[model samples]
Target: MTEQSEMYVLAIDQGTTSTRAVVVDHDGRIIATGQKEHEQIFPRSGWVEHDAKEIWKNTRTVVGKALVDAEINRHQLAAVGITNQRETAVVWDKSTGEPVYNAIVWQDTRTQKICDELAGEDGPDKYKDRAGLPLATYFAGPKVKWILDNVDGAREKAEAGELLMGTIDTWLLWNLTGGTDGGVHITDVTNASRTLLMNIDTLDWNEDIASDMGIPMSMLPEIRSSSEVYGKGRKRGLLIDTPIAGALGDQHAAMLGQACFEVGMGKNTYGTGNFLLVNTGDKPVHSDNGLLTTVAYKLGDAAPAYALEGSVAVTGSLVQWVRDNLGLITDAPQIEDLATQVDNSGGLFIVPAFSGLFAPHWRSDARGAMVGMTRFHNKSHIARAVLEATAFQSQEVVEAIEADAESVGVELTELKVDGGMVMNETLMQFQADILGVPVVRPEVIETTALGAAYAAGLAVGFWDGIEDIGRNWSEDKRWEPQMDEETRERYLRLWKKAVERTLDWMDDDVEELFR
Candidate 1:
């Protein structure tokens, strides 16, 4: 047996664009990491899919690569934590270990009609009171419905209790434990809360909601706390027999990794999208604003911590568009350098409603628009606009959070930031300037992976407690607001104008094409 000192925690982060395996030592530092990006399948203009088999294969590969890089075996691993892109639904056969269809990505907007039908009469907020989420295409429930309704034999298989439904976290968890054999099918409170099928208060699947969607109760994974010994790794895997203890949605994992355990503390993770979550403590704080009330995390046998989250659908992905779609920059990081060449966007405002706006304003009818473009505006100006778009979107969510938190007297003094986009100094500075608050970055930017490691380590007693996790957190750098109130207000006004131009752009004709 490996000594306690020699043991480490492993975190598998199955993200929107990639899968990553990270090894964390006792000091909360990442020792080794392996990452691989899977293909983003866009079958139509608004539909997004991922090959679940490919994701699973990548997961295995990364795990082995990380273990080999760290010069460790399965015996040295104390436990395994799984964090994933939340709300991406996968319905697989329980016996075959094969996905029924490609996994529906969270960003996919093909379920708009389903969402509309679900929102009939009562509108999108029909289930918001119970599920803490609007009936939007951004969630898993509608996506699951789309698959069952469209795919041949899917509904029959689901009703026959042969298919199992789960988000990316649940999918990874089942495969990691032992797919088609004895895999423990379960999801944490955080991930479950994102699905419209789960009752937010009870922390369980709402049978009424499932019945409404024509989904079988058997297809749902067992709900579990964020930290617990769910199961062990499969015999054939690199983490064979190691405890698979923790699972969380990527954003919630970032919250835990940022150590925002206290009520009123919050963190904003800039990734494929920007998710800003503010801890609202034990009892759920229902949002009057467009924010979603969600489970932050639930440690083993402990009451769940709740949060108010504002999700922006497009942030870093917009940068990807500028890189891949437009030939503005060769690399993602290079955009920062080009953006710095221009002091501002030169009156250009980009509303990246690429897949529609999320949080504060849930408008699926909206589409991407670049307003205030002039002949004088060059690639540098476009780069600046692209980076500023992320900041502006985040600001909108922060405002919504503040409004929702105000009733409870919870205020956000500062924001703890993380993710791939946080490395861009240009964007970080602009984020602070636009928010009018200091933005702090931690020494570990990949909080999503670290948070999962903390959960797994805690469940297996590799770490003492939440306080132990807190001690490991330290600030790497800080960005203070530099823009004056007058300038900030002016930029905000222009941005709002640009956003308005995007709305209702996907009108009747656009709806016809999708249908």
Candidate 2:
């Protein structure tokens, strides 16, 4: 094998809004990076889509750009790792490699009626025990079912085994490895766990669920470990022959990247949404506290570790809505500057239930709202409230996690945070204050990509083991709670009040508008 120190891992992070590629050296430092944003297609109110072809194109573009930026070639990369938005379902023809329909984003709520029907028949928690998920539109199974039922000739093709279904990670992996030319169809346990079709205990597709949902079992991918050489890269624009080694859902990758290997260690990723996952060791702890039981990651043939996940539907995306829809700010980053101008939200609260609340309070009926706003409040206050919304949402999840952990006799001491929004010092500090725990930001904030890189590098013998990657983790900054108990209580109260106002928003009139 080549000296472990010399090889690089090309980690691809295909996200909701963008595609990014980064080259990481053995020491876990990002040598070079490239990123490109894609369009957010909203076919109608409460629906979202992404062109899989455009995503594939963006993947190639970013990979080429990263290689150029890093001054490296395909031969220099030891392996490729992929991390992507989980639960975004895509189905395509096996022969043509074209998606049957635009990829259904995880945030899309068009399947709510489908979910409601299923839950109504089987009860909302019917599959929760086996699948480790609730009957919600946030999962891949309903989305896949929606496409198969809605799209033209999809069911026939799927049942005939002429189609394939997978999450974004599986789609990218197939395209990266060989596309229509013998591309391997597979997904890691971490990604598979998000799909309601997978049995969390068996670590495979649940045949019963598949049958019940009317989904053809043949369309599913072979489940694989999070780290393994699935196949050799082929026909990729800039990468060829290199091993495609690792894959994870983005949030799971962040947990691995943060090196939260030990039980009770947790991390919060503030991406398009906010997700808090705590490593729950080998056994999946079924959450009675409105969290999801998920596979954190399964290394090569080892016992699949479990996690309790608190998924918030909207956080950073709220910032984008303020910028693009409301014109409150020109760019995402300016929210910080504008928000800092205010002492507080000026008694206003922004419950960005734009896609409804997720985690702890899975209120799909909720909608976006700016409550308690008066003439005295300005955009700066709204901006500050917007930023605070992320922190507040996270705090809700953390509270639930703490409750779940307490049941398991584990107490969380600190939170490890990563992702784009972690760069916002105000948000981080406020998050810390809200939880009353120190929020530690790793030196490598791009832990999602780094985690994928580590997985790929490990699989290809570029590193010794998990210990080697653990050494790469270093704390760059830490924020401790600053607000007094009274202030904290007041903020929580107002935030809860604002959240309550967003509920039951999809009334008959609103539903009629969408129709």
Candidate 3:
């Protein structure tokens, strides 16, 4: 066994594109990491899925690789933390640990019709007061309902108390603790807040909402706080008997990893999608705007910290589209270089509503559109348009946040950022320019995993408390606004016009084409 001073915590970051394991020491530095991408399954145009079992297998593989890379064994590990893609749901047999259907990704829009039917005459925000979320396809509750209604025998099995449904965090935690052998089935408040089933105020499942969605309460996991000893690793796994102490949705974990402890402190994570979250202290701040009120994190039995979140469905993934689908760049990093080739988008705007727009405009009928394109524009100019789209979308979300926070007297001065896309200098500078605020990056940009490790460390006495974790955060770089206000406003005006072209695109004719 290692001494307390030398012990390390491991974080399993099960993301949308990949599963990663990071080993972090007491100083909040990433000592070692292991990552592997999983296959993305698209059965139809609007549906996205992942193999739940493959994600579990990759989780174990990455953990083993990270431990070996760190030159440590299970005994040297203080605790295990898990942070994962929120709203990606899985339904599995409790006894067999096999998924009933493919894990429906958060990006999937198969449940739009379900959400519409549920909204009925009250519209999308019908249950917003109790749920703090509009009925949408981006959440997990409808996804669970989809599985039950479509999958053969899933409803029967669920009603009989044999099926289990959870986000990726719950799926990974259940298996990490012990699969098919007394595995603890649980999820943290952060993940539960995105499910549309858990009441944001009570932090418990709303039987009315679940019943409305035609979901069985028996399939839901026990909702727990973000930090605490959930269970121990299974005897068969590499982390045998180690305390599994922390679980958070990837965005909430990023907020914690950034050490945003004070009210009004916020962070933006640029990943497959971009999520901006601002801490609202102990009480939930209802948003009249498009923002969603969610539980930021709950530590042990402490009151849960709430947040107003603006979720954009496409950001970094747009870069992937440019690279893979458009063939504009051979790799993701090349996008920055390509974008810099042109002074601007050369009068081109790409509204990447590939899976419909999220955030301030929850237009499920919207589709991807590339407007303001001239014959003079080239691929390099297109690259600039792609990167600019991300910044514009983020700016809209920030404006909505500002509008909502006016009542509470909370203001966001700077945005702490993390995730793979932060490395793009072009995007970061533009993000700051558009928002007219400083965008700061931390020394450790892998805050998602680090946040999970912090929770685990605090829970198991590996670290003293939030203050100890806060001391480890240090700024690495900052980008200040450079574009003139006049020019920025002009560009934003054009971007909004481009966005308008995407709305109401999925009419009956469009839906019939997919069918």
* Among all candidates shown, the one with the greatest lDDT: 3
Q: Model 1, range 1-515, lDDT digits (tens) per residue?
A: 67887999999999999999999999899999999999999988888999999999999999989999999988899999999999999999999999999999999999998888878899889988899998999999989998999999999999989999999989988988888889989989999998899889889899898988888999999999999999988878687899999999999999989999998899999999999998888988888889998999999999999999999988888888999989788889999999989788889988999889999899998999988878999999999998999999999999888777667567878889999999999999999999999999999999999999999999999999999999999999999999999999998998888889999888778767774
Question: lDDT tens digits, residues 256-319, model 2?
Answer: 8999898888899999999999988998889889999999998887788899999998998999
Cα deviation at 380, candidate 3, in Å, is: 0.5
lDDT of 1 at 478: 99
Candidate number with the higher lDDT (2 or 3) = 3
The ten-residue window of minimal lDDT in model 2 covers: 401-410
Q: Which segments of model 3 are wrong by more than 4 Å?
A: none
Task: Give the better candidate number (2 or 3) by TM-score.
Answer: 3
Residue-wise C-alpha lDDT for candidate 3, range 275-313, written one tens digit per residue: 999998998888988999999999898889999999999
TM-score of each: 0.99, 0.98, 0.99
What local lDDT does model 1 show for residue 514? 71
Q: In model 2, which regions exceed 4 Å deviation?
A: 1-3
